[model samples]
Target: MKDKIRIGCGAGFSGDRLDPAVVLVKDGKLDYLVLECLAERTIALAQKRKLQNPAWGYDPLLERRIESLLELLLEQKVKLITNMGAANPLSAADKVIEIAKRKNLSVRVAAVVGDDVLAKLDVAALSLETKQPLSSHGKIVSANAYLGADGILEALKTNADIIITGRVADPSLFIAPMLHELGWAENDFDRMGKGTVLGHLLECAGQVTGGYYADPGKKHVPDMVNLGHPFVDVFADGSGLLGKVNGTGGVINLDTAKEQLLYEVVNPHAYYTPDVIADFTSVKLMQQAKDRVRVTGGSGTTKPDTLKVSVGYQAGYLGEGEITYAGGNAVGRAKLAGEIVRERLRHTFNEIKVDLMGLNAVHGNALHSTEPYEVRLRVAAKTPDAALAARVGEEVEALYTNGPGGGGGVRKYVHEMIGIVSCLMDRNLIKPEVIIKSI
Candidate 1:
């Protein structure tokens, strides 16, 4: 059995930088490169696209990413894995073929499907959060379970060059290759848990490497625009050394590592997953050198009887308008403009959000300030009908000639909103399988 394997994260989310991944492939000495690009609402958004055309539910950036990285990965003899096949892995697999064929390169591609359980979902079942059923939503769009590593492993067994998955657990995508490469038994809980923590750290790609952790001057990071992605030298014992590539512009320290450790961690003791009941409390983090950390010792409880599923629904439509005002009493003028929009759309829309940008949009009037040269009044609303939502922009645009003086740079936009609901279901309800097509 191989004692060690290196896995580097190329794209963290759907819109991550592409150039940094090329650096990783060229210099990281990796066995596998992973791209985790799915978010809770990403699949729902993809489903909306698929409704318009059956062949288009996968990640929108799949083709671009493959074209950029295919030849480099092929040269390095590194395998690739991704959840870029957001809602349609099969279509994504076919798209990869088209990209590869254009470059005159042959590769094995596998699609991991069956996470979409919308057809089998019980609409009447109560939610895991609000105890409300799926019937309460305006309309159902997509429901996908967080699949485990079985399908990914099944694909790797066929010696596929790339594995595309739909709705797999964020960390599981990283864990499968470790388990497969190291010859770790599937039932080994402690090793899986340890490997999972490493995966979690790298899953967000740059987050663990000072991309999101950097605060200019306060928690300063040098050359953050060209932030480096993370890769782990994983050992067979379920431990790994975390570090970024050399000649990159990001810091990797205990602080960055610990921040990512606690991110999105609802319960430190019970970090639930489809594969195992991962316990983060047992994991140890030790900084052995600059931009390097030694990770060891994580254990897991028994696997959960139920799996958490994310259900997406057609929530409503959102319409928004923004107008900027500068010089002398800008905040006051913006506030007045906000009131005008609220009164105009309050009766028609379900919810209206009025905020003054650059002042209180993020904290919500907490740090009220009057000394400001410029302010932007943004009015937005959500409604069942797109027409009503569009009214928010129309009304805000009217402020240019209809009262608030100095209101310039008017912009308006409207888009469909997708909301997510969480639920738990029997593990047997959904089965994930690998479908392979070689070119």
Candidate 2:
């Protein structure tokens, strides 16, 4: 075998235009395709969907799309990797298997999981940065760890035509196969670095292809409905080139790629990942014209001493209904009324938290931990669902008191009980015990 590989990234279920993106890669004769669909909100969305109908969510959506792609890949014999499993990669695989059997495609399917750790956070543990115990605000909410490139490697080993995973690092889907086919070890820093950078470049798919680049005006965007998914050509030496599915929406020139690079990376020289800390400072970029950018010249080294953990703590609900101000100092009147409500609640309740939404400069120092502002407020607290929390919310609505300094009936203001859940995680736990089974 020549050991050559090309990778693509994007969701298979966005609009009616999903087929064009995947079929384009099949037509292009690429060796492998990687699709990523898991987002921060995806876990919750999946849970909600499952709640309504236990058999629904990202997995089925992904399975249907993969079936389409698999038929084409089988016709051309190309492998694939994806994280469309969202919160349930296994369920996604099962669905794909069923579809394959029905079609008599016999396309081998592999699933990578243990990445969706939405249920893993321990409130008693402190944050790596703040060193404070996590709040119980969202103690029972969702959390998922970002897996690295190894899962894709495992998929390739199965000789499977398609690999499905949940919440793997967006970049890993592209890099893992290249590392595996080329025989890059767990510690091959240089190659891993190249793969990591390539993954990051194409992870957002069309985003790097001028989706959010600010350069092209909205009216001038290429085929908005058929946005192109990203792809990369990795060489044996760990060097690579990035592009996308043919005839798709958006363009991937140097400017757009550079803009995507700046989207999240703070320091180019020290791009960190769960598997390795890649040195992107040595990287080079060149504008290869309207729809292409040439990325080269980057090196990698062993990973950092600490693994990054993504923690999601309990943050309470936030509700806001607008109230218009027409009178003189209407904002001031609202502020005073809010304060009175907070004071009354505090006086009536013990060990309960309360705040007046209109009177506090929440966006200022009070909420942001910066310098306090003179006016502007949003009430919230950790009090029980019924006590000060709900009471304070109701108080904000009762600001139209008929007493002194109160005349204009306060418009019904939306009251919300807010809890604090920190979604930040930085704990690294590699080398976990994997209990694999033949499905």
Candidate 3:
């Protein structure tokens, strides 16, 4: 077993920059490069696209990212782990193979499947909020369980160069590689907890590296425009160093790491995961250098019996339109324009959100200045019927010459919003399957 392994995070979410991965591969000489690309709703959107085209459900930029980082990844001999395969890891693996073939580079890509439980799950699955069954909502789009490091370890056993998964837990992308490289036992709860803590710290890529922590004068980051990706040099004992790329803008400090540790974490004493229950309450973050933090003291308990499932459903059709009014009497004109549109769509839409964009949109009348120079009249609605939703924008457009004057740069949008509901399920039923394919 290796004494230490260096893992770099390329992309934190679905639309993260591809340049950071390139920078890491070109300079870091890392052992593994993981890209956590899937969010809860991304799979539903991918499923929507898949319904239109059977072959396309993965991340839209998967091919572009792979092509951009292929040469560097090959030269650095860095294994890739990513959840870019949103709703379709197999198709994404095939796409990777195609890219490798086009470039005449030999690569083995693995796809971890079985997270999708839409077919097996009942419509009566209770939502986390109201405890209402999923059937009580609109049409359900997708249901996926958060898979853990099991599939990743299975895939790595096949000696794959890259691993792609659908709906795996964010931290598993990093933890799986660590397990494989360190040859750690599956039941090592303490080490697993430590590894999970490390994974959580780096899962968001830029968050712990000062990218998301910057608050202008309060936490100013140098060269914030070109913020660097983060990498961890972790040992089998669960101790590690957190730092960013050399010569890149961004700081890795105790404050940033601590802030990230508390992100999305409800109970610091018991952080639930598919694999193990990690405890970050006792973990310590110490600054090892100018842009490096040493992490230690993480512990883990037995795994949760149930896995968290994210259910995506069609909430309703959303229609929105906006028009800007400037110069003399801008706020008055904007308010009138908003009222006009609101009045027009009153009968058509079930619920509407009408606002004078700059003046009373976000905080309403709670925090605002009177007599603004310019304001935007924004009208939005949620309707059961797409036609009614489409009409909201049309009604706003009709106000051009009929109701409001000096309304410029009018924009409208109609979309079918996918909403999410969460529930827990028996972990045994949603086992992950990993398969490696050659290119």
Candidate 4:
């Protein structure tokens, strides 16, 4: 096995930019490039898309990403692993193969499947969030179990240039490479935990690289427009140095690394994943250089016997409208506009929210003291009936002539909202398979 492997994150989520990935492929000298593009709701939306069209469930940008990077991936011999497959790995693999054929490049792509556990899901299981029966969540569109590194490691054994998966844990995409490249044992909890730390740090692509850490004048990230993605050089023991592309716009200092460490972590002592219950509390981060941080000291025990399954169901529909009011008493006008909408819809819709964008959209009444010269009135409501949902925006648009004066830039939107919840499933129930397609 090699002494160390270099892995870089290309895209953090669905619709992330492609230019940063191109830079990594050309100059990052990475053995693996992971594009973690799947989120809980993202997969649910993909399922909805699949219901509409059989061939369109995967990441919408999959074709463009494959077309853009397939040539460089082949030239650089950098293997790719991504959860961009979303709801359809088989179709995603086919798309990649088609892209390779069009470009006259010979490559083998692997699609990891079997994550969908909807048929096997027990509706009697309790929801981890609401503590209610899964059956009570309404119609479940998708139920996917979080697969670990096993499926990916199996794909690596085939030497596939790209491995696409559906609903695997975010960190598993990065951790699998470490297991395969370093020849780490599957049951090696300590090593797995360390690898998980590395994976979590790099999973968000640019978060640890200063993208999410930027706060003008306070946290002050330089050249925010051209922020670069991050890469880690991981040793067999799981310790690694995290950094970004040389001369890139982002910084990888201790402060940025620490923030990412605690991100979305409910408990640092028992951070759960498909592979292991990583203990981030034990992790040590030290600035080794200008933009390099040495990470080590992560450990863990055996992984959970049950895997988390994200259940997506038809939540209802969200109707939203925004109208901007400027000049004197703009906040007052916006507030009045919101009050009108709320008064009109309050009896019809149970979940109605009205906010003044520049004043109390985020903090609500907590920051109502600020009186801005210009403010946008936003009114939203959730309802089961699409017609009723449509009325919410209609009422806001009517404010142009009916309710408030000086109200302009009316924007309205209505869409079906997917609700996500989690339940635990036995590990033995999930059987991940790898299907390889080649041009």
lDDT for every model?
0.89, 0.61, 0.88, 0.91
- For candidate 1, the 10 contiguous residues with the lowest summed lDDT are 363-372
For 139-189, candidate 3 gives per-residue lDDT tens digits of: 999999999999998998898989999999887888887788887888988
lDDT of 2 by residue, 188-239 (tens): 8888888787878877766776666544454256785666667777777777
Q: Each candidate's TM vs. the true structure?
A: 0.97, 0.71, 0.95, 0.98
lDDT of 1 by residue, 76-172 (tens): 9999999999989999999999988889999999999999999988888887777889769768888899998888999999999999999999889
- What is the lDDT for 139 in model 3? 90
Q: Can you give the lDDT of residue 370 in candidate 2?
A: 24
Compose the digit string of candidate 4's lDDT tens values, residues 1-439: 9889999999999989888998898899999999999988999999999999999899999998988899999999999999999999999999998888888889999999999999999988899999999889788899999999899999999999999999999989988989888988899999999999999999999899898788877998888788889999999989999988887788999999999988889989998999999999889999999889999999989899999999999988999999999998888888888888889888888878888888888987774775888898889988877888899999999998988789999999999989999999999989999999987
Native-to-model Cα distance after best TM-score fit, residue 295 in candidate 1, in Å = 1.4
Which scores higher on TM-score, 2 or 3?
3
The all-Cα superposition gives candidate 1 an RMSD in Å to the true structure of 1.4
**After superposing candidate 4, which stretches have Cα over 4 Å from the reference?**
none
| lDDT pick, better of 1 and 4 | 4
Error of 3 at 57 (Å): 0.8
- Predicted structure 2, TM vs. truth: 0.71
